[model samples]
Target: MTATNLLPRNRRPADGPSPGSARTKRRRRPGLMLTLGLTGLGLLVVLAVVAPWIWGDRAEELGPSVHLGSSGEHWLGTDALGRDIFARTMVATRLTLELSALATLIASTVGITLGTLIWVSGPRIRAVGLRVIDVMISYPAVILALAIAAILDPGPKACVIAIGAAGSPSFARLTANLAASVAGRDFVGSARLLGVGPLRLMRRHILPNIAEPLLVLLSVSYAHTLMALSGLSFLGLGVQLPDYDWGQLLAGGLQSLYTNPVEAVGPAVAIVLAGLSASFVGDGLAAAANRSRRADAPAKATKPAEANAAAAVGTAPAVPDDAVLVVDDLRVLRKDGTALVDGVSFHIGAAEIVGVVGESGSGKSLTAMAAARLLPGGLHATARTAELRHPDSAALDLVAPGAENAETRRRLAVEIGIVYQDPSASFNPALKLGGQLTETLRVHLKASRREAREQAIEQLDFVRLTDPASRLRQYPHELSGGMRQRAMIAAALLTRPRLIIADEPTTALDVTVQAEVLRLLRAANERDGTAMLFISHDIAVVGDLCDRVLVMYAGRLVEELTAEDVREGRARHPYTQALLAATPRLDTAAAAPAESAGGPEASAGEPASAEPVRTLAAIPGRPPQPDERPPGCAFAPRCPQVLAACHDTPPPVHSPAPGLSVLCHLEQAGARTGETGTDKPLEAAR
Candidate 1:
């Protein structure tokens, strides 16, 4: 079956971040130094911006002659022209800093925009743009600045343009490379499928994730711009005379270096300090932001609350009742023309959750993504035939043999929404949550501006985010991990989609949050009758969430049964049986004493007590690789139940009942014998 058809339709509200957490962790090394540096920089900036008013005519006044040494009248003595070095230094520092800041801003804005455009544009456009940027970078920046300065009037504007142009190529390349890499992430694909258009996607999703690197580049480039401006001013090709620029001061001081080296050293020190401060602040912020992100990472493994909630959600729905999604003969082919998913088929009913469980590399997630028409890059479904069934209409073939068209895909997107594993990576960090949420509503629902905004806020509320309206104004980073995932769900629900594909949605979250999210999803499904195709590596989670389960092995469906059937020890396929045995059971005898133990005895029991450990029987070997399939059965090599005929011929799919199916030679043989399939022993199959 097609992967897109694997997911069911149901979506819960978006979750927000943890409350009362510090905005970010404190910076570690150089914290005090960084603070001082920033403070000094801020003071310098203030002096520069207000230098005209503060220094005024006094800046141009020639102080007492014989300006060497710190006299009471002239601090740090005076320059060759007898201008007060203290005043000139302050004014010069201001002008030079201004020039650098403007140049840096211009360079960053132009470069990042161009880079992102190239990254997202068609391949031919990106190729051409990259080549142009490469050619620009080939020229020495200083030489280019010199030529440009000579062509234009040498002043602040000229310096700004020169430095900005010189820096553009580097920033462009950096931004483009970063954007391209982020675009390839699964979250980007999720955003696109969420109805985020290219422009909004770049602004909202692409920009935020790339901001930290861009900020670092901005700081480093600011230092470069300052130096470049100084070079041009020293050469008399930047900041005109009487402007009191540091570069000009330095050039003036050069003539009298022997008489007063302090003149040169004074302005030189200011320049160095400015650059150092910028670098320090950038480093500090970057480190702090990174630490904050790491600390905020959701906990792994299921939490007690989440497990309890899953258990409280009740039983899985019976199958063949109201199939929400259906797949037939779905196949994914490699570039070498080999099939990965080979003729897989399955079905999920309304308000029903279907679990696709498999060992690593078993094409589980691949099958689920295909159901959403979201296969990995360059991997196409060669022969897909799938459908999504709704209460009001006939089943829609998502991948009809010859009917893979844009309209069909759009229809599927409007009806089916997918939530991926990584929530942080999924959102556009640059954009506020409100904008991202509104975009989804506008696109699929054609919601008006006011209506979209209102709906966006409402959707946030649906996800249980407190103060949803205010949260909308905040950016993705402002929210916690769980909150981001919740926002993703809110965006998905804006479409009122009938089917939701949750591909390991809770994998990245802490157990507590994962439980909340699972409860929310179950509520959405049961209350709204939206079907869901829930995919996960954790069989235990599947057993808790899904009503029916489809076990996949090496790209093919190995078994299909109700969750109850699997729990009650009715799994027919050997792979399915192994998966059931592998689930961790908390209620087992091993868990009872551990729960009751206390103090020193409990600690001692943890080390030596076997207590009938509820051990999972792990499958012995790695699952079969796509390129290396066994003849009769994919599991034969790993199967403890292997027989001679299993290696030579493929097993027939056996359906003991209307809704259950298994592919095993043993089951077929047992049926062939006069024995009932129920009497077949697990060891005999192994």
Candidate 2:
């Protein structure tokens, strides 16, 4: 079903949830499971605390005779050793609770610290530590506990120590995953650009974001500790036998079960109750956490930036005199000699929207990042010649000294605005939507708080957000997906940057919202005279909106098409043609025509069958990995028109039309006969 059909029938185009929903679930305590779980847990706590005074002072004193049945003044009867069963049960429960709680504390402290540290560490340390953690994670918890118990003193102290050590690995793994996820969010990237220190970022943003998940993990850890404590005691490695922790009591009572089963039955029931309580509470917490996240997630299946110089346009300027951004052979490679983006080059004229289209792993995003020089943590990016000449700043090499540092970031922020795919991740959860936007102004424009707030309001209005003023007070979770996206665009535009680098900014939105956002971006490009490098996986969006569409495959630009070329399905490269053909169409059951499949290339030799193939034409095989790209053409292995020469020699780029280029042997040879040229004027290519 389409995103529009999934929404409420009466829903307005620009609307969102109530502001109250954005309140973090951490503070919301109500819910049947939470209440019941807490009540049950509280009861357990009270029982453990008052346990010592509940039974008579002499818990160990002999009660009349051994194996006595329930009688007046001797509730729960006497055990095999003539000890009062009631007194022994209470004492055992108290000791079990105490040791398990201590164990959980130790596990949480050690695990969370180490996990965060390992997650943020350099690649070398992260790799070695992760391998060690992997080995530990593979070990059975029982075995881990047993080993620790065997190594240390074998009593309650060792029992707690063993439980903590055994449980720490699980907590560490959970924390690491949580941290990694938080690190991937766009807000974290924003913070980094704003010069937030690594330590500060984690403490303020990462930790709080992971708090709810960590709370659930803590509950699970408690359950693990309880089980370890009992199992250890049962194996005679826990609290000393005479002191009577839960497992030891049960074991001692089992000896006389045939004669008096109540003694053994009682402790078994206690263990079951304690375990059930923790599981119930943990499940409740997990459910609540999930609910909060779901509520925060904008409901098309959900639902789903910048610039200025950028601000004046009555008519499109015939082409700009000089390109605003230019790059000559940009390369992105890892230290391991793996090339992710190979010898890529492109330019954006002022106010021109250039769209990069490719499938996953086609290096579309990596190429876009080359413009901002934000090519992730370890990889290196260099351009034979890279220049960004913004209206407000002198031209600077994108690969110059301190390029990866704060100085380059300042230039980028002023000259180029970046919008990401997931708007929800782009804004900080804890900050109000207005505050984040305003902070951008305060940082880049050096606007005072009041001035920033005013400018932020103007930006919000510019994006046509509803109730723009009130929205400033709402946290990101309060807004719908579309609203958040508009807010992100507003943030990007705050600096009035001359160019915008949008990376699949519309991929997360529904068709209607996507169309709306595309309109906004187009207006930014045309009205504000701001150029754009639009990166997207959506071919349709590129066809409808971009002036020039670039087809990237396996780290190489295979084809360049004009808006008319893409709209008319005139892709010249087999890879580009395959991409167009693979896209689903609602107009007719017939697959895209032969011209659409490989443009004229797919039908270079064969006559069109009387009936066009109705089946969707899909290109087989995935894109080659960075280290596995073919020596010649990367697409040759999957290309329908593959030739021996195609596999032996890479095809050079050819211009079939003024502004249209393709990297295909057939297109390069002589496939242009009888074909119409692209719509873009020849001068546009110059």
Candidate 3:
């Protein structure tokens, strides 16, 4: 009853950028120069389209004065034949644009189709296509165009055919490469599992995402087509003389160069303008598309306190001396400077298994990824302090730019191994198992091929993956799910890393397989004295495997306790308590409904209104979305013990017991010792 809701009526991130965060929102404003260029192109296109009616043939016939300069009668002056250059240029644009459009159309249609086929094809066919494209790319486009033109009567039709043929292979190659990358993404894999047909996925998801790229390619390719058309015509295999296309005009001007040079330069200028216009317009569309995608991204907010982070973070706890990894005041912010992981601090000791547990979207994975220095693309992570110490090496400050130090980052990259949720996607399908697994040893250990091979097989067998020798030869897709995971762990072991960060590595496996993988992980830690940070939403597994556990809620670390406390369900936080209650119990039958007025007596004579409404207790609503997250305690809205200050002030981490920390106002109520009843001992940077 004491909890208050101070959130605005319509929930959204508060307006204006936070100080020093340099937050930038992507704007949908169109590019002014691009608009003008496109407008110019539009006018040229209209001239081409309406040339027959708008442009007068009266000026097409030869006039009395040949090679005359600009006058009232002739705007662009007289050509060598005394024909009006303005009229000739207008008609030439019609022919030039038509040829370019036709060639591009033919090329794009054939290219996209062939590319899709190549992308969807089996390895053998795809390899063949790639080779053929490579050969085509190496061969000169001009020679190919010339040969086709000579073979097909050396005319306009032949020129168009040659241009299309020359352009198709390039487009096919681009589309095939882009399609392969897009198809490999997680969302596309999800779509496939949902029974969405390949064609539907291509048309609906893949094409829409790649639309901007394809259009830019089309525009740039259109310019190429235009140049090719003019070149072939200028070489006499294209539009004939007296036809006076831009190329022919250029060709005709050579003899008169000393007298009137504009004839030659005029067509060159036109071509350059058209090429630039096309490129500018295409670039604008790509920018606009990029903005649209960013706009569609889910809204995220960095708490306002982050603007005054130095004062706000007034922290607690220090990284233990035995700590192999120490992260102080870590934050992961969105492009808009919204915090995904805010002011999270923790450490992992040598040879210790630490569990980071949270519901989905609680920033568990984000924090882990940041600590590993592998935040996903577009997400930026920073820390007030970060120092990773290896027993044999100096401490590496991860807060520094990755390139600022040479040896430290290279060493850390090899020393900290990672196991992902989906093992199959981690390995490249094109690589053999042995080659991929042995690659880690070759990189970090600098082991030779034979030595790496031996180690890889030995590690694979250690993980209990049967037929280690056979798995080494097989491709990733050839292995079963469990085999793939075990193989992944095998690869990680090859590094002999001091620390392994497993981010829900068992989530995608069957229960039996999951147990086997978890066993392997435990065996790794026990046998090698390797520290492991296991992240998962399954509290039971965390309890069974971890020495200590950290609980995250709404991007903040809310509680830290021993794994023994987790197994005993002795959590002090209401959110964790609710999570425990909601987990289904299989050792006993489900509890019966609560008694309603002692049953029989109530049914006999009691009014219906007198009967109590007996319903199972459930958490009332969903976790607040990113934009709607509470200003104070993120969990306060749902917390049964929420206090008055819980609605207005964020809580700081405090030690409730030895090696135990909780971020809750209730946990700190009795311990407020400093000014404003909100201060705590600051966490040490080291």
Candidate 4:
């Protein structure tokens, strides 16, 4: 039931179908419900826009002088004023709807913009802005409107501004909070590393993801604003008596409610209906957006198609003699000065794929980010010198302190791209995918709008996205998970960078899509000679994609080996061996049958076979905390191969072969004993 039991007995590598072909077969096209809902919303918009013109002068005309009840000549009857109830009601409804709708639009626009800006601004600015908004929202909206209307003139515009101003703070606070939350997501970090500036990042990535909540806020706020406007109008501080505003109608009808109750009820019903319709539309849009976002959640199950994709692109490119990316003694320390990555060194040559593998918090990703000078907040990289080969100059040292000039950073961003774990969260919800992709091309390549657009489409095509031209018009929310990831990669590749850093690129995708992406990356390396540094926690993935594998443990390099070495069970480090042993094999049959008599297996020893009821072994205890690291060796406490010397002196790096290295006291002592080639530490190799 444990992970080890999932491995195949023989463990032969799997050969499955290509991810692109599998996606082609299984991709769910957009359903008709969304299309129909959008159409209905569009019609409602038209109705709201032209309702005044349709009802026209009839609103002022007196009906056939008939009283209440529905009839041919005076449908829904005449009011106490003998006005055409149907016509007047329509006109009043239009006016009320327009004013409230306009006010709502203004409020939402102002609120969301302010909120997003506040969220993007520093903590001090946001604190002040939020306090100011809190003070504004404390007052009752109707009182605010009345106070403003009493001072300024009584008019619809005055009512709208006052009501909108009152509602603005709420929406602003909501938007700012939403934007701030999304701004910290992995996708945003990825976009930043891609060299997307703040403005473009907001427009393309942050805004779109927050649209659903914003729409919901707008809808609810519109209803509240409408009610406030009506209340003001009823109090004679709104659109004035002469106009056919619904609130005024209700106010006038209230005087005659004893004799003609229908007068007040008719306008009242219209107000309720308008509010209902708007609420429905908002709810529907919000529901649709929620579903769309959920649909893009990362895949949890791996598929055969992914295996095939890996197989198809499994071949490694010839490693160039000159290093394209070089990292020397790179160290990343936390804000508290505790090392997360310490003294790690590696290099990727032209057209090479170097995979960094480790358990969680092994610092593989930190190392990759450090190579591109894109460390996360609160983490500082020191003792580093990452050199990147530039087409115009010799190898440029990217990790050298204070080397990040604007022009230099920009050049690196354009020439060296990164693909992140979560692609959907990386994009701006407000902008179309095409626009996002094109902006990268325009900024980095200096392509004209038309040329950039063309390049965007071309990049989409390269990622194997179907209907590349039409797809460009779609936003990130419209695309599937795999499609969104592909779009992100396309955007990265548009600049035609010489090197790429892909951090868990397949983690959020279905196995099929993962395979397709892996294939695409391999092809990029082989066909375009784009050197890459790929980081993952999955050893199998590293084995499938990388040319060379670097194993890291507790912030230091533990072992370096070839992909073939890993596959052939030649890994030397105990951690590396444990990782290989822990990987789940797709070909293995489940020990706990699909349905169990007792229950599902949640622990080690659930019967799988008659082979003495083997129980899966788990690595017990947590990794060492950064600050509490042991003096002699950070990992020695947990390492099963501990020795007396290990507690006193830290291990030094020992090279057993030209390209292989390990940092362990055991390996060091073995080297000293002149048994370098034959010595194998602790567990069986791999």
Top model number, TM-score: 2
| lDDT string, candidate 3, 365-405, tens digits | 88877776665545778887777788777887765764334
The candidate with the higher lDDT, 3 or 4, is 3
Query: Global lDDT for candidate 4?
Result: 0.69
TM-score-wise, the better of 2 and 4 is: 2
Highest lDDT, which number? 2
Tell me the lDDT of candidate 1: 0.72
Q: Report the C-alpha lDDT of model 1 over 116-162, residue by residue, as the tens digit.
A: 88877866898899999999989988888898888999888988898
Worst 10 residues of 3 by lDDT: 677-686
Please write out the lDDT profile of model 2 over residues 1-686, one tens digit for every residue: 12222332234665554557665443355366667767877888898888888664657787557787677755667876688887888867888888889999999988888888887787798778777778898998889989999999989999898889888888788777777767767788776666566777788778888888788888767876887798889889998956778888888778878887777776787787787777768877887764233211211121000110011111211234468887766667766546677767677888788999999988899887777766676677776667888555578788764655666666766677889999778888976776677765677567899888888888888889988889999999898888899988988888887789899998887767876677788877776788899988878678778899988987777777787877676777777767666665554444457557786667666755433443346567788776666667888788666667777676766665666667778865664322322222111212
Q: What TM-score goes with each of the models?
A: 0.73, 0.76, 0.57, 0.69
> CA lDDT, every prediction?
0.72, 0.74, 0.71, 0.69
Superposed on all Cα atoms, model 4 deviates from the true structure by an RMSD in Å of 10.8
Native-structure RMSD, model 3: 17.6
- How much is the lDDT of residue 522 in candidate 1? 80
Top-down lDDT ranking: 2, 1, 3, 4
